[model samples]
Target: MKKTFVKIGLLLAVFGLLVGCDNSSSEVVPPSSTSEEVVSSSEEEVKLTEQEYQIAVNYIVRSVPLVLERGVKVPTNVERAEAENPLPTPELKYGDNLLLITAGELKYEDEINGVYLYPEYTVTYSFLEQEPYAGFTFEYDDIGRYFAVPEYPRYEAEYDNGGNPIHTVPPAKAARLYVTIHIEERFTTFNMDMILEPQAIIHDYNLADVRSVPTGSVVRVYGYFNGYFSDWNNGVLCDGDVALGLFKLQEFNHMELGKMYAVVGQFTVYNGLPQLQWIKTVSEVEPADHPTVKEPKAVVVSADDFADQLDIGNELSGPLMHKVGTTVVLNFPLRYKAMLDRDGNAVEPGALELGKHADVVLTGKDSDNFEFEVKLSLNYHMGTDNQAAFRDFFVTNADADIYFTGPLGAYNAINLAPFAFEGTLSLTPPVVS
Candidate 1:
């Protein structure tokens, strides 16, 4: 399944550049040598459940481009359907809403084989609440197999009470959705691009509707490069000290620190976060005088919530999954003085390191006083400057409000320990016990 997904991703990237090509012979494989030439008596029609039917519809919708690549006109059913609900319109944006095709609305018209099936469906580009499995299985019953297209939500938009826009895109511009489809038995796949148009472009969002826009949709955002995430090949853009979005580019080697700039790109969601990719650099501007740093959301959970922590598989599927790689404030007080050099000893705020750097354990209780624990580490050995700054901030234990700020990192299954990002540090001074 992983290999299949990789092929699908690669195929989409290639299809985006190569519009018309008959490279299907190398990519697609027939079920059997003789099956491609003739259908066997074992062929059967498999009735599909509602969910399965929807998946089949999505598979076909995603296959339109592949069919076109074969130099064949799109199926009349598909072209007609698309004509009725064309994307990139002035009302709705693709990925913003569902395109419902009731039962019998879509009929499979096999021009070559003359096979057919009527299926019901509901397809959307909205962000799914729960992450889907990395792999999927397709069911087959001879003739042609039905495959499920993996759904990856580009972004989840946040809105205001009156249904007005906030930090996301306004109602006027719709998002564009690019889809990649993979077939199982006859190992075939293709790609398609869909765009939904907004009714009107209203200047209503606080941050110019940058973060809420969809992938492949152009946007211009105003922000400053606060830091860089080398792993993802993106530069952290922030409203001030707070991370607002990511600038998707190969490197931020030439980016100036503390200077404001207007970044233009197609907004996308990567690893469950908002980002701007295919970046277009605009001119730089002066930094904001009094930009407020929007604090991370406070999450209150108990020890019981992480009781079965040693299970690495469940760790991500568990309660802390959403908090992974996100800036969050664990709203619980620390029960151990583990950040200090000596046990039970308190160090000054700016004290130097004692050479012994290790994982620090933080234990605390929720509002009900139920205990929970989290592990933190400072492994920033990239450069002396980063190491020195981290050592100075973490080595000493001073009395002040403690706030965990940075991405949540590795997890110790044996000890049920979840490691905080290397950059994780107390936002304020730690309270001396």
Candidate 2:
């Protein structure tokens, strides 16, 4: 009985807020599962009024369309990222950066808080112009569609009249708010430059992003970069929501950090701040089989982190290994990649791409620690549509070098991100460990 009333109250509150703006200290809508909706979250717990709930539902419906567009679709199905495919090469600008993240393995984490939150994220960056020595931290736009709590009532009170409280509930009964993100600041520096040298020191903070920040790099990334944020230390970037100032880089081939990117052009201090004019681009991708480097470094995620299923929000990491034999294999086949379709013949990955995305695949031997096949398929993802419906994108039938027969469980799982770029090369001697 009590539970039912609380739910009803929540609905009413949410609806009310939806009808009229809450005018609370809200910056942005959370990361909508669908693209068009404005999903925001509040740290406090509150029972949404019906008005707020109605607002939420409508927002959700609208948000869903943003992630899925009739305009552009990936092999998976990302609405906002629908414009991912570009026919003619576009001029790279603040806006054109989106093209880089158009398809396949097009996402990465910027290390917020203590973990790698959001599989799809913009690279963390800072300029010699910024004040803080540390680069920057990032957070999701509250993809859960959570709203800021309007301040929880001291007690969940219910009254038939306008006089006294007839019944009450605890804070636990109120809606629970969540802040989903982790941050990690690298001890790197960015030098001022007009030419964006992919290998510049400042680029070091987000070497992962800049390295894969070009079109056709085959790397996919989610989220956006900070423009001019106010609170640099608190871990948030870009103050207001109006500028819509975010550089979403999705498509770049993976590679080693410093070696993959270089600094270009000239940087100057404008009124005590660093300013950049023309960050140049490099043409070549880090060779898949680069000499002198290792192949297939492993990044393990405990089964617990993914909740038995991989999710877009949350930080994840572990040991990295170069040899396939050292990788941790999972008991179940990961649906992250694709194989011969139900039809049998090799299904063109682009055909399977229902959304804006590319595929990440590997060709090698199963390691001793995590024995498996060296199958080729997609791994990472980057798009505006980050949510539950994405499960359909994974495949389980690719031909791997080795096959598993028993229930190895999550312990068998391994992450191949560290080795996506630069393969072990015959020409380059392996550096002595």
Candidate 3:
């Protein structure tokens, strides 16, 4: 069947930051229900009237695509910062410390400096411990010439008017935050190269409404839920903007750029230039919060995973069974097997293993879920007969109750050749109606 499924999103910021997002809620599904007079796809002959064939075929065509569109989501958060007295102001310009972060630990490469945080929290400023203890190390130097602190002499010249000891310098301040967030909507498209950069912010109020907020000043944005102030060129983001003219923030050095970011510096109109600085903890930034998983539901659908490419969303809802070594003697008509292998073949010992990309799915009455999977195989009788006799030998639930009632000859056309299918099928994880 021709089905479609996927969700993705993207946005760019100043300094060439790029953000892409994706989330899916799908997994392996199984089958559970059965029909009253439905023709099971067993290798037996089923006498179907014209009306019954149409009803079953219509159901299979509409359900599979929905599975792919619903995808799964997982959570991840990471942070890091340097520790120094009156410490260091993280900057991108030369001679400053380069900060690198992951799930844990902060490495001040330039200073051969390494400091561990509160295990779950991180610090970014150059501050002094409020209550210094014996187990903790705290010391100062008299001839301090490095760092962003004041340079003082070891001793004062002895004079009647100025023989005094110099006062000690204070420590700097820094902090880090941890949080969790939800991955909202996901959309995917190929030609989005122009959606780069949310920089070059220009705010303006209409001449008719001067009471409205101005265009280029910092402000908080709020919706029915809530909102926050956003900064350009300061995220592990790539968004094309005016202020971050040629800085390639989209450049990924270690891992993917999607994993790195910075929020520091000032927002100013440098000459005729207008832009926000690369944010470096304007405040202790908190991470997004974790989300909760929903309660489970029933599943009336399932699939046989013979091939790795088997997608569970596109199957019909009902009981599914598989038998390989012999001709199937249940549900379907005996003629169906003969038609499947015109030469009257038996099972090939243990040759009925699932393949790489074949699968079978049975849905509920409304394709709301899956049930179980029967793993078996059958012989393919394509080139055996002088005429193409076994060409119609596949699986389907379409030929049920084919006589004079409503949908008397309707049948599902969703079929897969065992020679082409693969699986010791299972149908429990996906939809549960």
Candidate 4:
């Protein structure tokens, strides 16, 4: 996701404040899977049954789209200093009285005393009661309103401290006085049949159109399955010159190569490459009806042309950025010079220990002498023997001209991870004194 930075200021107002109690001593009862409508009362401190508490949590979870639609609203009484500052305060706007919510590391606030607080706010809520409400908590950042697109909550499988998947109820968003309470009040009349139904609207898009939108957009696209990268734990989809990387693909193991598939997922960017992550569905296309299920051919280009496509200053604007996930046949004339370790440090050819991956330095034959020193994953699908053979062949015959073919990829710079070594040619020896 793209990082959005905003200047936040404290807003003081005269309004009834209903702070919640923090029952840390009370055991946290997990929410239930049943989608029962929770009847809320206007009276403060309304006691709830275990199932009702679970229903309330589910209501909050389902209301994320509605809350985001309402967005953050700043009070009219906020004051700003006129002094020039690096972080300028944004102008207040009239909208729904909603607080921007987030969790994990991106959260800007920390819990102090019994309340989850933001640095910009002077007011804090303390929950001191041992009630069912203690099981539900949320943190908010008003500055998040400045984001071009808000990050919506996604409830997937829960994980343990050790990063292992565990079966449990998905966590709920904290209560905002304006939004959460409003949702709670409506739940009294809300239909229980639509409790588990999805609220967000997804749109269909092609690979080219998907590239133009911001990250975090939920979209569906149709493309030919290029292949899967075992090293990266992701797949690829291609439509002509454009290709999109597929991450968190649940159906990757069962997918066939060169087949058309209708994929629904959230568009995201990892490093500098565009990808669809947290895949929702993958439906295969019938080959007999749709005869265009042929494999995507690589775009053949010289090393100079490939280098020119890179715009290091602006990753999104470059020609190469558009082809980051597509297959490419890089026809370059280079002489392998040295074997490098993971840290890009030069290592002796004999001392080079072949692990799951290795890197080699290949210098271009052109006058500019462009270096293809980016680390390549040599033994992901290929075994250590293949890595050793490539190393020995290139290192022993240092003057051999080489060619490469693989999907275009990037980290901080362009890389050909899990690339194939097509072939090599003997270079003519130059006369020496």
Candidate 1 lDDT at 358 equals: 38
Count of backbone collisions within predicted model 1: 12
The TM-score ranking, best first, is: 4, 1, 2, 3
TM-score of 2: 0.18
What's the alpha carbon RMSD for model 2? 29.3
Error of 3 at 419 (Å): 20
Q: After superposition, how far is residue 78 of candidate 2 from its true place, in Å?
A: 61
TM-score of each predicted structure versus truth? 0.32, 0.18, 0.15, 0.47
lDDT of each: 0.38, 0.23, 0.19, 0.48
The C-alpha stretches of model 3 lying farther than 4 A from their native spots are 1-296, 300-349, 352-355, 360-433
Q: What is candidate 4's lDDT per residue for 371-406, written digit by digit as tens?
A: 545445453455666677777777777766666666
The best-first sequence of candidates by lDDT reads 4, 1, 2, 3
Q: Score residue 185 of candidate 1 by CA lDDT.
A: 24
lDDT of 2 by residue, 1-433 (tens): 0011101000100100011122242422244311121122333334444443433333332222211111232221112124466232111111101111110111122356332211111111122213222111222222322122222223322333222335543321112111111111111111111111111112221222222232212121111222211111100011111001111112222222223222232222222222222223322324342332232232233324323222221112222111112223332233223333323355554455433323233323222334222233122232223211222323223333222211011112322321122231122222322
Better of 3 and 4 by TM-score: 4
Clashes of 2: 123
